[model samples]
Structures are given as structure tokens and as C-alpha cells.
Target: MRLISSSISLATAAALLSACATLPQGTSRDSTNTGLDVRTRYVGLTSDAEVAEILASPLGEEAAVRLALFNDHTLRARYDQLAITEADLRATGLLPVSDGARTPEAGIALPVLDIFLIPLRNKQGITIPERIEIEVTDHAVALIADVRRAWTRLAVAKQAHNLAKMSENIARAAEKVAVELADKGNLPADELVARKIAVANAEHAVIMAESERREAREDLAGLLGVDLMGDWFVHNADPATIPADLNAVDMQAVMDNSLALASSKAEVARVGASHGITDISSILPDIDLAVSAERDDHQWEVGPSIEMPVPVFNFDGPKREKAEADVRAAQYEYAHSLVVTANRAALLVRERDAAHKLVKLLNEQVTVAADQAVAASLRQYNAMQTGVFGLLAIRENAVEARRHQLQGWQRYRNAEVAVDAARAGVILPLKN
Candidate 1:
């Protein structure tokens, strides 16, 4: 007797789980607020004006990341996904009901198996929104890593282009002197030809450097959503001398925060929920109850009937096996993700430390030595103790040393960014 009255609750839950194949188009303001709130919780910046302020001047790595967050359409779409998932969660929690009237004999038909599984379904519905939110944050952190990498490349490209121009100038001057000496019969023709070849090679280096700079600039521009026609510049600041303290890091916290690990954990939980539901559903038969009224000879009779399927051929054996296997696979995946995330964090920290040490060595010892060598050679040339060619050779060596120093800085900065990303729960490739 109470089954007829309780059927509405089961019907509503079933509708909540399976209804709404088509949601309303476009994001709601509330969903946008939720996305923005999550972003602010992680990114710290709250307004577009903050990003605009950073973009108004020279682009720093931080500014580049901020600009990308504010301008990238792909990131906006990710935020929109957060909104969409939130809508689904809300809709599932508040099951929609129609106001249309029902006939006296009209009664909801609910699978008896589903009556036991609605709680698990509700739990999963709640978990999905939380998982999607984590994914959104993961995407945002990934974008920041990408922007930082592009900024580093553009900075290095500019430095290389300047070095190439300096080399070109040196080669042109050497060739001019060689031409004059050859005209005066003071230099061999072959040596003059060699100087010309050196000039041509320097020109080629300049061209290649310019091309690289252009490509780097375009890549950074695309990330920042900025026009290439603008006079934006990146500061070529030296990387930090000190390395991050790896010993103080909490490995468990790092793994917990990792995007890959979190996604895997969510999957395991979701599959476990379904596995539990299916485990119970397999032991129970599919049954339904119907209430109807019949009138005959000006008399009305009301009765309730119970209907159940006999398990002669299908006993849910395959379904239960599948559920158990799915749960085991999800658990294994989560375990694998945990191991990979821990290893990745350790490796990135080690690499960052190594990069810092290399940069410090280049700055303190090798670069200073190269500079001193150049100065000594210049002084020797002024005293006529060294020829112009010898001075130029020493200068080239100094430039090479500087190039190595700059490259070391690039590697160190990129490594630092990657370490930061790992700490922030996103893994990014270290720039070479």
C-alpha cells in the first residue's frame, strides 16, 4: 500500500539521473562566478584590470602568464566547462518536476533495482563537479607554464639576435681591414678571401638569429593574445643564484595536488561507486509495482500488482564481473599515477637544483674568466703585443662564453618554471 505513495520519490530520482539530455545553451552568471572564484583561489588576481596593467608595459614572465589567463580563448572555454559541469550537478540535485495533471490510474514505474542505487548515483553526481573543478584548475596552471616557456624562448631569441649582430659587426670590420691590407700588398689574397667568407658566415648567422627571434616573438604573442605590431619587450634578467630547497618539500602533498594523480583518484572513486551499486543490484531481481482502478457495473475496484522478471537466462553475472574489473583497473591506474607523479616531482626538483648550480658556476667562474681574457687581449693589442687577428679571436671566445652563460640562464629559468609548475600540481617539460 505504501509502495504506491513512495513511487514518486523513486521516479523523481530516476528522472534526475537520466533526464536533461539537452541543457540550456550558454553559461549562467552564477557558473561564471564559481569558475572565477576557483581561479582567484589559485591565481590570486581578481580583475582584468590587473592583467591590463601588466600588459601596458614591458612583458615579464608573471605578466605574460596573467595576460594569457585573461586573454586566451581556449582557457575561457575551459572555464566554461567548469560552468557546464556545475549546471549538471545543480540540475541533478534539484530534480525538475512537471506540473501537468495525472489520471487516477496513472502511477510512476520505477525499476526496483534502481531504488537501491540512487544514493550511489547521487554521490557520483556530486563527485563529478568536484573533479571537473580540479581539472579546470589543472588547465589554468598548464597555461601558465606554457606562457612562461614562451617568454623564456623569446628572451633568449632576442639575446641571440643581439649577439649575432655584434658578431656581424666584428666580421665586417675585420674584412674591411683585410681589404685595405690586401690592396697595400701587406696581406695575402687568400687571407682576404677568408675574411670575406667569415663576413658571409656572420651574415648568415644574423639571418638565422633574426628568423629565430621572429618565430619566438610570434609564439609569445600568440600565447598572450597580443598584436605583434606593438613595441613590447621582455627583460633579460639573470636567473636566481640559489636553488629551491627540495628537502623541505612534502612528497605526499605534491602527489595529492598533482593533476594526473587527482584525475586518477577521481576515476577510482567513481568506478568504486558504480561497482558497489552493481554488486547489490546483481543479487536483486528487477521488480515493479503498478496501481490501477477499474470500474464495472457502476462499481470501482482498486488494486496493486507486483511484477518481477524471473532469472532463468540472465543473472547479472557478466555485469557484476565487468563492474569488479572496472574498479580494479581504476585502482591500478590511480596507483600508477601516484608513482609517476612522485617520480616526476623528484626529478624536476633535482633538475632545477642542477640548473641553478650550473648557472652559478658560469656566472661566477667561467664568465668572469672569459671577460678577463678579453680585456687582457684588448690591452695586448693596444700595446702592439698582439695582432688584430689575435684580439678578434679572443673577442670571439668571449662572445662564445657569453652565449654559454645566457644559455645556462635560459635553462635555469626554465627549470625553475617547471619546478614551480610541479609544485603547483601541473607537470611541464623543462626547456633545454
Candidate 2:
């Protein structure tokens, strides 16, 4: 019977040990979509499909913006940082304390006296979470600023593409004119060659413009958490239509809303002071309950616990200094950012105003040049005294005027984008 019992106990022990030693299988540990790679979806999209979908599909813009929001690796990392800080805050709030031990001894020969003592454990208070919260808030604000910048870039790219298309149309017309003049033996071969070169350059410019537009779309898509390969397009919203009115903004009022700086300063102070003080709490039985136990000859005693850390080696001296320095650094950075933003806004506004003036001047010049070219051409052609050189010169002047007008228009658009960027407190709309 004893041998049978021993065998049963050994078998039970082995089963328990096996259960404890076994680990979960790969399938059990795997998460939803664990084997799939999200990035592959983007890589699978052909360049032509990307461009065609962006230009033709209604979902293009939405997908692009969403990709920027979610798939952009950089933004994803920032989100992860924010999550970590949130977890840290939760951990800080729960402040764990170690349990104390109790031991009992019989009162030997002395029947009238009973003695009991409990060892106390000391715990130092932690205040790093408050500082961490401040840092996280600052990071969040910076991330928002980054998003604004990326969006501005996206907007600028779209405008550039539009301008490039316009330029390409003009270049094609000029090329046709050059070919006709060359066939009539009225223009030199060199002039025809120049026009052909201009056409090629314009075509190249269009290709570059398309590339930039694609990059901007991808950037914005990443920021908005959309698939890069997804069909989407950004609506060509005229950012220039928005007017900048200084009266609409109260600088002082806006400055007052810097909560990150304020919180950081407060946190620094809170953390520094907390480092010098110890947090104390009790987990002892009630005195009345102890007295009740005393009547049963197993007397319980009320124990006082002292929790403290001996500041022999690490007194958090360096840590306090670092915290104070961080507060100052944050203040400085906040101030600097405000100043830089204001300066940039002012500069962009001035640039836009200048570009608008230039555009107006170019428009007037184009009108006057067009009238001159028409009058010159008609007089020379009707009088039958028109030289090839004179006719070609006038036509060339008209073409140059048109080119200048186109350039002015492009500049105006660019300036408008700049002004919008300034007002929006960002340089580009597409998130990098």
C-alpha cells in the first residue's frame, strides 16, 4: 500500500511540473493580422496607379491624409511615447508598499510581563511622474506643430503642380509657333532649337512637379493614418483665399494659452520639493482588536512603523539639479518658439504683399505689350513693308510678355501658400 501511494504522489508531482513548464504555442501567442505586413500594401502599388488614382479617384485625398496620420512611422513613434507616459502616470498613482512581518514569542518565567516588537520597512516617495507628465505634454504640443508643418508642405506641392501644368500649356503653344515660323523660312534654325529646348524643359518641369505632388500626398496620407497605396486625392483648396487680418489676432491673449510651459515649471518645483520629503502610511491592526486577543493568552501589541530612507549615498542631488535645468530649458524653448513663429508670420505676410504687387505690375505690362504686338503686326502686314525680323521680334516680345505673366501668376500662388503657412503656424501641410 505504501509503495502504491508513493507512485501516485510522484505521478501527481510530475503532472504539476509539466503543466508549469509548458509555454503557449506560436498560434496562441500570435495577434490578429500578426503575419501580415501593412507596409506591403503600399509597396505593391505601381507608380502609375498611384498617380492615376490620386488624380481620378474621389477617395484619393482622404486616403492620403489618413496615411499621414497613421502610417507615418515618425508620428506612430510619437504616439507610442505618449502611451508610455500615460502608463507611467498610472504606475505613479498606485505607489506600492512592502508588507511588514510579525513574530510571536511566549512570555517565559515572568507571568506579569508580555513584550512584542515589529520591524518597520522604510519607503522613499517617488515624484518623477509629475515631471514625466510635463515632458509628455510638451512633446504632444511639438507633434501638433509638426503636423501643421507637414500639411503646409502638401498644400504647396499641389499648387506647384497646378502652376507646372499651366506652364506646360504655354510652352506647347510656343513650340507650335516656332515650328510654323521655321517652315515659312522666316525664323532661323537656332530660334526653333531654342523653342524645342524650352518644350523639353517644360516637360521635365512637369515630371518634377508630379513627383513632388506624389511625395506630398504620401506625406499627408501617412500623417492622417491612411494607406499610401489607397486611392485618394487632396482637393485643390485655394489656401490664398483666406485673408490675414492682424486685428483678428490678439498676441497677448494667445501667449496666455501656453499651458505646457506653466505645467512644466510647476512640475519641476513639485518634483524637487517632493524629493526631500518622505511619504508615510500605516497598515497596523486596531488597538481594540489587539486587546481582545490579549484576553486569549495570545496577546497582540500595537506597533508603530517608521518608513524612511537613509540619505547616505544617493540624495537625488543631481536629479534635482537636472529637473531645475529642464524647467529653464522648457521656458527658453517656449519663448523662442513664440518669437520665431511671430517673425515667420510677419515675413511671410510681407512677402505675399510684395508678390501681389508684382503680379499686378506684370498684368498691366502684359496688356500693354499685347496691344503693341497687335498694332505692330497689323501695320507691317497691311503695308506689305513687314520684314521677317520685325514681325518675329514683335511676336517674340509678346511671347516673352506672356511668359512673364505666367511666372508672375506662379509667384503669386507661391506667396499665397507662404502666407497661409504663416497664419497656420506651419510651413507645410503634409506630415513628414
TM-score of each: 0.70, 0.44
Per-residue CA lDDT of model 2 for 354-379, tens digit only, reads 66676676666664767588687869
For candidate 2, what is the total of clashing residue pairs?
34
User: What would the TM-score be for candidate 1 when compared with the true structure?
Assistant: 0.70
- Residue 50 of model 1: what lDDT? 67
lDDT of each: 0.61, 0.42
Cα lDDT of model 1 by residue, 242-315, tens digit? 45443455555455456575566556556656555433222222222235777869998664332222122232
Off by over 4 Å in 2: 1-136, 244-247, 267-432
Q: What is the alpha-carbon lDDT of model 1 when measured against the actual structure? A: 0.61
